[model samples]
Target: MTSAPLEPFAVTIDFATGALVPDPDVLDRRLADLDGYFVADIDDPGVGAYTVHEVRVPPTGNNLLSSTTVLAPGKVGDEYFFTKGHFHAIRDRAEIYLTLSGEGLLVMALEDGRTVTKEMRPGIANYVPGHWAHRSVNTGTTPLVFYAVYIGDAGYDYATIAERGFPVIVVEGEEGPEVRPNPRYVAS
Candidate 1:
């Protein structure tokens, strides 16, 4: 027996609100959810950090997966709010992020401890190559919104990132957001 074919559908992105019309399930991350991901402890861990809405799809074949991440602007000890970075479980699966509103940075790191950062702003699309662990940091005073697309089977390997940490971090500086080496990084 064979399964039915997947149907194509359309979804609208409300750029101003950073919402997906028709409403996809949202994953909310509070500071509490990011325990060791930051450099300092927050007085209120229950404070909202970021939210993610992903269009669910089968994790197979060439089907593309799409998601929207809206990172709230704030910080803990000068370190900006950020997503918990991850490498694709498949290792060779690449992804692209298109900034819709606000400003931020796309920080990517290689296993060799090398790192690079891409400025994220409206109209800019950053390509994250395979094997790079990537994270997004909200550097502006408003929510940083972006849409990401990647292969369906490009499962996330957050454990490696949680265990080893990224080589660099984004922090608020007198000149604005700055990228600095993470003293706690453990090369994998």
Candidate 2:
């Protein structure tokens, strides 16, 4: 009896041709940067309200390619605030949030400047559509923890985020107050 010849199962897409391929080693190394608990100061404007550590993922020497590990608004203690904004670049893929632990509030800003807020607890799955602007804040008494899983590169230029200025934030306060992006929070 004769056996049939083996066929190629490999397939490729033009869009993914020049994209930066994220490797496991690079991802693990980059993610290692954020290895501790972070705190945000609510009353101080000079100091950044959010604490962020980055996982550095170098580009694969490809054009139209970029990737990085960002630990933003992950764990919150008692109180926290996230400024409202949106990404100008329309992401072709959807973004997901994996709740590791804790609880917080999710805020979405509309094009017309209108904002919507939701109460979020642990085990809650959050999905943000491409190009959708959103933010999260911790309102619970305990620290809120979660993982942000962003898939598909959307240029990595968060255009929707405020460059510099006081952003809109809704919280349980005596008077409605505006919140600004923490100075320490750096996006790479």
Candidate 3:
């Protein structure tokens, strides 16, 4: 027997507050949760870091999944607060991030050592192509919020990134946010 077709539906999202009307499954990443992901150790482990609230559909075919990431503004040492970056498990899946509020940097890097950084602000949509591991960095004094859409089946490969760090890092500089080499990076 075959299963019934899924019905279409709409979910309301408040751009200003980054809230979904029906509520969403939330994954809160606290300072303690990101053990080795940062350059320095936090004095307190319970500090609020970032949150990802998403509405997920079935992980089949071309169905799309959407989520909002709110990264709290702070730092460990001089490095800014950032999401735990990941590449799609499928390796060829792409994603897009539309900045809703605050300021941030979309930092992406390839396995071959190529890296790119894009400024994210309200009204800007950054397209992340396939095979690049992408991380979001909040460079402002307020929360950095962005809406992201990706294929449902584009599973995340966070382990690879945890094992091999990104080639570049973002840090506070006298001029502004500066991009520098990640000395801890190991080749895959």
Candidate 4:
């Protein structure tokens, strides 16, 4: 199967409702469920609350040029499925998340214990600065999906978050999922 430069591709509906909403058995990337995540609530670690399908590029010296990540929707107990947030290993490298469809929030935290949350919707772009740790949640009934572009060399450092999780976690709100301080964490 010889391919050409800038080959046109398509995005299919792979998942929704926390299930593997496969794309009619088409497309070429492997659908994988992320492993080893930190559950905000220790008692109920609802595994596989969400899934991810990504198109990753190989290393190109300094960094990979671009990549795409599509996250499926689900939840752990009352909390929504969210990306295990992280700060870039390189520290100075920032990232952008452009919402392609659905709805949710881009929750961020400053090192000084301050936190911020922004709504995500189609046609909106969230600029994540270097110092904050960022994560995305699926607040909509449908699969909350988005496309992301980031530096190739900017690897993910999930340990800092793994050890000292995010300051707040989004849980089922009466109106929708709302942000609440993580009880497991004691601010110091």
Candidate 5:
């Protein structure tokens, strides 16, 4: 396999809303009908709520798989829209996320029961070590966007999160979005 160029790709697209992200192949994720354990009873938002655009690269040359995450602005009841948090299937593979635009928070849950959250804005980068399950929450009124890179073989274990929800949920607050303990969450 030919090695991919490390040089920057000229393709430009708005990361916040994925203005020009390739279509017919985008992988979308939605929280409208999740078990409703972390959110409230609500109408389905369908599958267009959020999307993952896989960046084209040499499939056999690089060990890293890159993607741009476009999270829509809205609410699942009082809770903000968020990524379905996951721990890498490889267990020892880490991931990195850099904010492109908009505002949000990256919430991370550890097996040790500790939860950490970081505010996101343009140019901010969050490094998630192995063994942590992380989710991204859109706290602002606009779309939340970011770039992420993780080991190609890492694989996401979303089922574990579905079984064991995050201990905290981001909700609208008087000043801004707040992170509060999830009433329905039971730590595993």
Candidate 6:
């Protein structure tokens, strides 16, 4: 018996030569439409100070451009799944977290499940591997805001992670809420 030929993964595209690259203009239009669709709470309960805005391109093949705006945790009382915990992924790449406002804890989960939580303030930045499971929490009375930029695919495979719910470790409790991956995170 013979097996069928495997399909090659078309992840990267050539732009200088005008290959099968994603259209930038098309992506800009989509991002503009998503200016303020969803928002998340940081840690404050008084107001919805901390929020995440999605600026992502399509998640089809690969080569993705995306960003998220994390507002300072405020008085918003909405239940955000990862408010007390963190999350991660399966692919390998580079990620940057740049603080935009206030202060908080930046939690990164190790391969063994143990987490390395860091104190972050405005103007501070941190970098980690793409596959590392991680999350941010507002530890201060003020909201902690930042931007997480991922330089990889925008497939959003983890968008359904919250819907499926995963067991998580968190501060202030032994058990935490089930978290789904962000929709803006394009899964490779």
Per the 3 Å backbone cut-off, how many clashing residue pairs does candidate 5 have? Answer: 0
- Candidate 5 residue pairs in clash (backbone atoms < 3 Å): none
| lDDT score of residue 156 within candidate 6 | 32
What TM-score does each of the candidates earn?
A: 0.96, 0.48, 0.96, 0.71, 0.84, 0.49
lDDT of 3 at 64: 90
Candidate 4 or 2, higher TM-score: 4
- For 80-186, candidate 4 gives per-residue lDDT tens digits of 77777788887767788877777899999876668999998887899988777888987877767666667777777888877677899898878978899887654
- Alpha carbon lDDT of each predicted model: 0.90, 0.40, 0.89, 0.65, 0.78, 0.44
Error of 6 at 186 (Å): 26
Tens digit per residue, CA lDDT, model 6, 157-180: 343333322223223322532233
> What local lDDT score does residue 21 receive in model 4, on the 0 to 100 scale?
35
lDDT-based ranking, best first? 1, 3, 5, 4, 6, 2
Report the C-alpha lDDT of model 5 over 1-188, residue by residue, as the tens digit.
Answer: 35455766534567656544454347766655454545687567574467877876543324677878888888877888888888888777888999897899999998666899999888898999998899999888788889888877788788877876898899998898899988877676
- What digit string (tens of lDDT, one per residue) describes model 1 on residues 1-188? 25787898877887866799766679999999899988787779999999998887887746899988999999989999999999999998999999999999999998898888999999999999998989999999999999999999999999988998899988888998889988888886
Which whole-number lDDT from 0 to 100 does residue 98 have in model 1? 95
Q: How many backbone collisions does model 6 have?
A: 21
- For model 2, what is the error of residue 155's alpha carbon versus the real structure, in angstroms, after optimal superposition? 3.7
What is the C-alpha lDDT profile of model 3 across 16-102, one tens digit per residue?
Answer: 667777875889899898788877877777999998889879976468989988999999999998998999998889899999999
The ten-residue window of minimal lDDT in model 4 covers 25-34
Off by over 4 Å in 2: 1-48, 53-80, 83-88, 156-159, 163-168, 173-188
**Cα RMSD (angstroms) for every candidate in the order listed:** 1.3, 11.7, 1.4, 6.1, 3.2, 12.0
Q: Model 4, stretches more than 4 Å misplaced?
A: 1-47, 58-65, 186-188
Candidate 2 yields a Cα-based lDDT of: 0.40
Q: How should the candidates be ordered by TM-score, best one leading?
A: 1, 3, 5, 4, 6, 2
How much is the lDDT of residue 10 in candidate 5? 39
